[model samples]
Target: MIQIGDRLPEQEFTFITEAGKTTATSAELFGGKKVVIFALPGAFTPTCSQAHLPGFVVLADQFRQKGIELFCLSVNDAFVMRAWQQAQNADAITMLADGDGAFSQALGLAKDTGAFGGLRAQRFALVAEDGVVTELQVEAPGKFEVSSAEAMLKRV
Candidate 1:
């Protein structure tokens, strides 16, 4: 698992917006910036739709006020991520698509869910400064707690 003081691995993430499809490398997103990144199993799922993503959306301003960029990541396609962003009215959050799960695997956060979903990212959140992790919060199987937006907000 990725730990505090470890730099984010080199990876590219997809971002779909009203303009068009674009790609952002890990370095481009985290380099020289204070960033908060939260990853969920999949997009549009119950827990993620109702609580996980919404929490971040609701507290985006607070994170911004503290000079931190907020990112919501998932192992779904760019199109789905874009739709979820719109559905959740999460305009303040930057949604990134880890379509291939490569990023999650690199961080040792990928999990197999059998029928629930093939390869998905475990629920996790981390605080990084200039590409190096400062803090990490990972939830246990079938649980949501430490990695939540409200919780991470207090920690950051």
Candidate 2:
């Protein structure tokens, strides 16, 4: 997996926001600002629903105060991403949809979620500034590790 000090994968992903939709590149999000981006296996799953997303949601304000943008990424479609954002009440975070798995693959963090029947994102977080990856946190499968938004905030 890619590590700290490595440049974050420069890839474009279409974010499926609840209000609308738009495409953003990695550079666009983190080029000149500090960014906290986490990847999830899939949206609406138990662990993700109750823990992963919620952690970020609750810490959004603190992150913003620290000049960080929080984002959550999944490999689902735009509609699913939007619905998940609404269902999870994640108003403070940007939900990005990696529908084609291209971005995740490019990051070398893509995973095969067998039961979901799809290539999905792993539980990972990257602290990026000025388009460079400053820190990286990767969790084991089925185990949420250093990628929690709170963890990232502490690192900052």
lDDT of 1 at 38: 98
Tens digit of per-residue lDDT, candidate 2, span 1-156: 777787877777776553567888887877888888899888988889989999999889999998899888888887888889889889788888889988788889998867755798888998888877888888976788799877888898
Best by TM-score: 1
What lDDT would each prediction earn against the true structure? 0.94, 0.84
The collision pairs in model 2 are none
Kindly report which residue stretches of model 2 are placed more than 4 angstroms away from their true locations once superposed.
17-19
What lDDT score goes with residue 86 in model 1? 97
C-alpha-based local distance difference test score of model 2: 0.84
